[model samples]
Target chain A: MQSTPPGLFRASWLVARKDLAIEFRTRTAFFSTLVFALLGLTIFFFAWDPTTVAAIDLAPGVLWAIFAFSGLLGLQRSFGVEQADRAMDALLAAPLDREAVYLGKAVANLLFVGGVQLVTIPALALFYNVPLAGIALPLAGVALLAAIGLVAVGTLFSSMAVNTRLAELLLPMLSLPFFLPIVVSASMTTARLLAGRPAAEAWPWLRILLAFDLVFGVACTLLFPFTVEE
Target chain B: MPQQPAGPVAASPDDPVVEAEALARQFGARRAVDGVSFVLRAGECLALFGPNGAGKTTLLRLLAGLLAPSSGHCRVAGLGIRDGKLARAHVGLVSHASMLYGALSARENVEFAAKLYGMPDPAGAARDALRSMRVLDRAEAPVRSLSRGLQQRVSIARAIVHSPHVLLCDEPYTGLDELGSAALTEALAERRDSGAALLLVTHNLGEGLALATQAAIMRRGSFVRHENRSGVDAGTYAMEYRELVTLDA
Candidate 1:
């Protein structure tokens, strides 16, 4: 008798878990992203004339810029990992729910991007000599929202890019257009929060980021099945 | 010994587990699968022989639901492959691609496949399948660390971890040496003996004919000839295939 396929949540969890297991084992993608983000920050540190520029003003954009670009490395690894042995063929051929695969992959990308951010945020704070003081929670909130948006579109484009011959060149070209809104909103929100502006001022950007997240999250989750389908 | 051409009636004792009726898949101005059809009974294996670009892999992909047929219908265990989940639930594929996570241990890779299929006992089933492929001793080794032949064995283990009712293989022995090839043949035989219907596409006449209950030679996306394996010996088949392939070329 044939076995039952896992439910959406379970299957998605399994996919995410499997990817995480492999990522943890190799740490190739994870550390590369971490190092890239740190390297970007170091460049931003020297590039910015902190004596003349407001550290708070420059730091937010620098942080988001680093996060956005470094996140691509993680997103690229999303489906690139599956290509190692064409393991994706097995995933596609299985009785798997395509959406489950997408959600799982997106979530896994979210975590990887999140991991890079977790370290990058504090490190950026230290490098730029900015204190989180009162806005750490909201800073993290903004980071989370921005990451959801990044992974939503990143996951979609990653699936598409990997199938194309120009995969390496194509992913950034494809995802950057969609990711700009998040980068802009994230940097804007972080700027306000870092500047000690009232929650009311940064609120709109957060809402925009949240909306971007929900819209792309649902759409990408639904559209991913077709993106990877043969 | 197998009897008669395997159309849709050979060994009707068990219902046909896989049925393809005039299945065709087209790509841009080309028809990759031009109206091929077959019925495979449980415990039956069909070894399809073809030259390069003969659509053998395309046909297997069509059945695996990786590609949809442009026309006609195909089903596994009475359910449509295009439909939600049933087709995938009963089918397993072992392609030339090992389809594994290189960073993952062999056991972990099989466990992942079992989990996707929602097996009742994923760990136990994974171990059992790995052991069956004779790679259980290396189960803890990362797949990348294993030899190509051992990796092939792990791929076989992963494909069969769920005990699928139907197996679709596309040149599974591409990188195997003699030992690897023997292990794969044994794995296919075990699946066949367990009443799983199999469709294997290969260029290895000796091995393909050895395990096939029915066999066919395909050219330009169509089956030119199909006959019972019982009466079709390898030497005659190799000669006929060479002549047909040359003429087509």
Candidate 2:
């Protein structure tokens, strides 16, 4: 048997790697999230009549909305592959710690959401003619924070939704409510950056995002065992 | 594997792997596992037999530190079930669901589990375990492509990969064929020989009787009879089990 404490980090990383490898092979969550994000952006571009609206004014909301919808798409499929094939029980039975399972799922979600964000960023810049060069670094930081918080809550709720009869329907319903705070902070921060405001002006929203990320991340880590058991 | 000679039993119950006292789990007003108490030593196999809805699964979950008891306490390796992190290190479970990731192959599933338990050489350990279970040929196959019996075998391999001190299995024989069952029986016997306590819940009387050193029958929410294998034959045990359920009804 292995020793404790340090062994836990190894275990968590292994779990995350396994999930990433599987997702990389099938592209199940990745494709769905990417396509959904593109669709969301296209609809908003056409519906808002971006030709009339100032590109800067619409840029922040458009970016935040694309991420939010893409995240929902990824979260919906996060456990879908597991449930379709009945692998969740095997995972629950393994000697691994329950928190590792949460982390593994979270990492998988992050990659899929991040991949969508990577593609959507340049697309949004082109569609709205917003200057992407100025705010790239701060925008990346905000996006990372928002993704962590969103995936943290989504992963927790997805585990619960996967077991229910109405898994597809229930996941969004349960997840969207918990996401309001994250969406607000991310949108506020992005909006400020888009307006060419200095980093100091957006620091408050950054703080809120950091706080949400820490709390939800820890809570999901602790509560995962109860959610995944048979 | 060499067997140990019979020796004098220890007098003190200083560190039982499993200890449940007046444990009961109630869903609303319905008592699922009621007033159950038992202590499992390190080198014993305790079979739990009951019909559907008799709370056998619930009791097994309680012992595995997977569920909270409504009225009593369940301890594994001297740690409370509600202790979360501490208790999980001491217990492992095998249920009907595969609980694996289908997108990944069988090898990846085991390695992932090994990582969760903080095991070194997770891939090597997982490979050896699958080979032992005769599922090595399918190790690289996605779990979705495997048959139910093969999947169950992978589930068993995953359960024992970390070598937990207490093994909790609920209907582990559900999907196994005869050969698969024999291989599983041998694997479990090996674990028992290594001082790991086995707590199993099953509806198959023949398999339960064959694998258990001691067996208990549950009716409604409580155990109605408990006996060692030497004390009762299979025919008499099954008859008594049926009678007990009938009487309760």
Candidate 3:
């Protein structure tokens, strides 16, 4: 009746393209996330007296904080879109691999959250007077690793929260606990990397971030079917 | 429309496209679908009528592969419901919800579905579906901007873009105006005439009675009455359906 279903990877790409196209056309998730990150940066900038604290000390926390919360905003919207008119019901009924849905959502969240950071990191660097010229490349590597863990767990939790009575309050509560470890590791590594510390010194923390990425990425992808089941 | 087929159709009965046996689905302490079974052959349209909490939705979901039966199994389009790929490929569902991306234009929404199913010419298929639904004039408009009636039309277009072997519609006529409802009736009739098996769940006896080759009434997760449409008296059945639907099981 139908052509053979595409491989899991190809199916995921289709789903990812759908989400990306929606986000691009509507700009709802994209602008909301960008604005949230920018607002958080401004508040933190004005709340603290830059004269008393050095930008190097402030830059690490500020960067990850912006990344995490803005990512939460994007993750929330990712599933929120599915809730409109129960669009998710149609998606679940489709014959594609269940894992493809999880992977597609994770990838979309990664790109959205990643896009916000790509802009915010540079802006924060300019405002905080932190010298990121030499380390921008390496710092990006750390951010990418940390993002994988956040998007993986966030996508799973968002799926769970949307089914609950109070999704607005529930998603952050369910996801924040999982997000803590990655944020901590990323912040510490970013702090060291910015301080001109040798790459070897930050390797241990990077390993922890890498492990979190691997563990949850695989676990969440496999667990998605159970969570999505009717 | 003819009367009921008289008995359960077998799994491989002369090209039986839909076959279910002892299908039961339980949710916590509630048995949503209890030991139900049926079969639908090509060109058959089975209209399911029931009250709220009668498990009609659950039954349709089970057949559409949207929900898994807890105890029994069924085959759709010659593949088990658990066979997500081939089973889903052969089915299309139109529910109260539009199940469309509100931000995307009507044409874009159907095209996305076509592409999702690996159709080679998504654009042309989308155009054909929209034209059939008579919303081709507004094809460029976003679904959110359209009226509820028009949105339902788009939903129908999206569901049938693949021309699936089985069409599952759960209250597809809900929220439609008089004209909209009439349009839906015609659309559904056309879909049935295309040789697709249909399982339409609704509270409207008149609408249900009109399109079904066989009609079934469900109560508390089981079918209490199923008869051939040709034998059913609409005026008398409507009166009985109203009374029976209001009574607590």
lDDT tens digits by residue: candidate 1, B1-249: 111111122245466788899999999999989999898888999999999999999999999998878998898877788886657878888998899999999999999999888887889889988988888999999999999889988999999888887889888898888877888899899889978889999998988988999999999999999888998978988999999999877
Report residue A128 deviation for candidate 3 (angstroms).
Answer: 0.9
Task: Give the Å shift of residue B129 in candidate 3.
Answer: 1.1
Instruction: Give the RMSD in angstroms, all C-alphas superposed, for model 2.
Output: 4.0
lDDT of 1 by residue, A1-230 (tens): 33577889999999999999989998999999999999999998988896799898899889988888898899998999888778888998887788988999988999998899889999988999898767889888888999999999999999999978999889999989898999999999989888888889988888899999989999998898888766
lDDT winner: 1
Q: Kindly provide the TM-score of model 3 when superposed on the true structure, using C-alpha atoms.
A: 0.93
Query: Candidate 2 clashing pairs?
Result: A11-B115, A87-B99, A87-B100, A88-B99, A89-B99, A90-B98, A90-B99, A91-B99, A96-B116, A96-B117
TM-score of chain B of 2: 0.91
Model 1: lDDT of residue B103: 91
Q: After superposition, how far is residue B9 of candidate 1 from its true place, in Å?
A: 17
Worst 10 residues of 3 chain B by lDDT: B1-10
Q: Give i-RMS (Å) per prediction.
A: 7.3, 6.7, 7.6
Candidate 3: where are CA atoms >4 Å away? A50-52, B1-13
Q: Judged by TM-score, which candidate is best?
A: 1
Residue pair clashes in candidate 1? none
Candidate 3, chain A: TM-score? 0.97
